[model samples]
Target: MIKYIDSYDFFACQLDNQRCRLLALPWEDVLVAHILPRLPLMQLFDLQRVSKRFRALIRLFFTKRTTFELVGHHVPKVAFFSLVKDNNVLRKLLLESCSSWLTDNDLLPVVSRNPRLQTLDLSGCNGLTRHALVAVSLTCVHLRHLAVARCDFVDGPSLRSLADHCGELRSLDLSGCCRLTDATICYLAKKCVRLTFLSLAVNENITDESVEDVAKNCRGLEHLDLTCCLRVRDVSIRTVAEYCPKLQSLKVKHCHHVTESSLEPLRKRKVLIDVHPPPRRDRLSLAVDCGPYVNIQPLSARLLPSGLNADPLRAHMNGPAKVSDPWKNHPSFPPVMPHLQSPSHLLTLHPSCLVLALRCSSSPSLWSL
Candidate 1:
């Protein structure tokens, strides 16, 4: 019984010694090296709530690697607010579709902290305005890839500020920014010489002049989207094909004036061009004038009765209603005799009558007769 008691006490002592050794070890180092890095972003945020020590470790992790992405529609606002509330080492921040909880105020505080941000994507964040973009441009001078697509409040001045500050910008997407004009694009083209990918889709005010400027200045451009830009014409396309040699993909969908002939040069260069079909003209407008014979039956309609008992030479001078399939029925004997009983009947008709029928069917207006 005494040996059993001694064994129990010995086991308890070993357990206590193990606990002491673990407590003596640097848990913060363990967390920073192993456990924290494995945890996902949400779990890391949750760890910050555990204690001041874990929060400090998270801050250390942020300092070590400045790239942070807070995307998703349901990401709690508090998560972001807490992240940027006190820290400022973030370099790449992407906040997409978080507009519900992410307001301009929340974003400004974060932006003010991360002055070295390189890649920022606030796409679909409608709450952002020109002021926010300007702040980003002025503060984040190293920005390279900026996407503020669908941010309606961004205008020429905001873009100019961004171009002026972030001259190294390589990719920019301002799609659906209705207020942008040629001036904004021209400024960007002049400043952002390294731009490779640009999307200015749905900016109706941008004309061929801006595209020409882009072709001239942004020689490094590879992909460009000018979809729904109605003012762009063949001249701009030809200019781009001639100048932007590195151009690879070009989107001119819904630009009615761009013709297939103008895009042939780009095709020769192996550029991927996306062009929508030209708007179709009205069929009635394309109809040829039939002159006085406009009342003549269409070529598709039966010009005479087709039966063994039917008169071969009798011409039917019926109106459009009497014409049987205007599309499929052809005038039996070329409009000459108006009616011919057979091939031998052509010799019997007067030469004038034959001439009149031929003229009627061959008339430009009666081309469809």
Candidate 2:
């Protein structure tokens, strides 16, 4: 119903002036204020060919454009230039879809024109190199929210340039940017102290140094993502929990070194984390389940006679080895005496009693003992 109504209103302006005069509202006001804003960006170009009146009205609409979002759309070069031609008051420019063709030359002019740009989301824009970011840092000083996710070509220098210039940045997403290192992150943490949300997910190079700096410098941080950061350990997580009191969400998935020792405290504070704490177990059950501790030192075969067997000692030192127990079916030993049966029983027996038992078992007359 809405599409039909909009279609009718769109074609109504194409009619002769005498018919347009019959309408209650003015044609230009209706098209510019109501009709033009509803039409797709590409449709506006076709509307321009309708008449000189529409072309002028579309241009006027572009002049007042504040937010131009073409996310996931395959915008052609010529069409993109045409859409942003007269738009200078833009506050937000989201061109995540134009990554395939968006180059520095194509984006610089728009960035230069819109100095008041507060939010720019160019995530997955792999074709764009650091030059685009440099231009943005220089031109869009008011930039507060920036997302360059998966843009691996973005290096430390470009980020340093951004941190030095855009001190007001609040939100940043650098996830999957493998080229970035700890130096870049630490530098950004100190410079962009106002950052409230940051993601370094899938970047294995970042460690405790960078994260600790971020936690200390960006104390106002609310959300952080460290997913797949294999080098990140408990120290960094503990630092984050200590420094960032405002932290509401933390993603530490796939960080193998980060254990419950650090995460348990954050759980107490009610900070949402991607990983779960380990289940509790009593110390006695844990110790029994773990079995006896052994410190087996490496032995040299050169020190022993060639015919001598060292396998039994090695097996004994490293704890029990699976084998047929010679005393199990012996007529002198009772099967009901379970402690004197298996190799595992050695862990519980006293050293002197074991020695005495072995000595007594050597003689057939004392085997019953």
Q: State which candidate has the highest TM-score.
A: 2
lDDT of 2 by residue, 141-257 (tens): 889999999997689999999999999999999999999999999999999999999999999899999999999999999999999999999999999999999999999999999
In angstroms, give how far residue 77 of model 2 lies from its true place. Answer: 1.2
- TM-score for all predictions? 0.64, 0.71
Residue range 51-98, candidate 1, lDDT tens digits: 565567677775555666766536777666666666677778888857
User: Which portions of model 1 miss their true places by more than 4 Å?
Assistant: 1-38, 49-55, 276-369
Candidate 1, run of 10 with poorest lDDT: 1-10
**Which residue runs does candidate 2 get wrong by more than 4 Å?**
1-10, 13-35, 39-42, 279-369
Per-residue error at 161 for model 2, in Å? 0.9
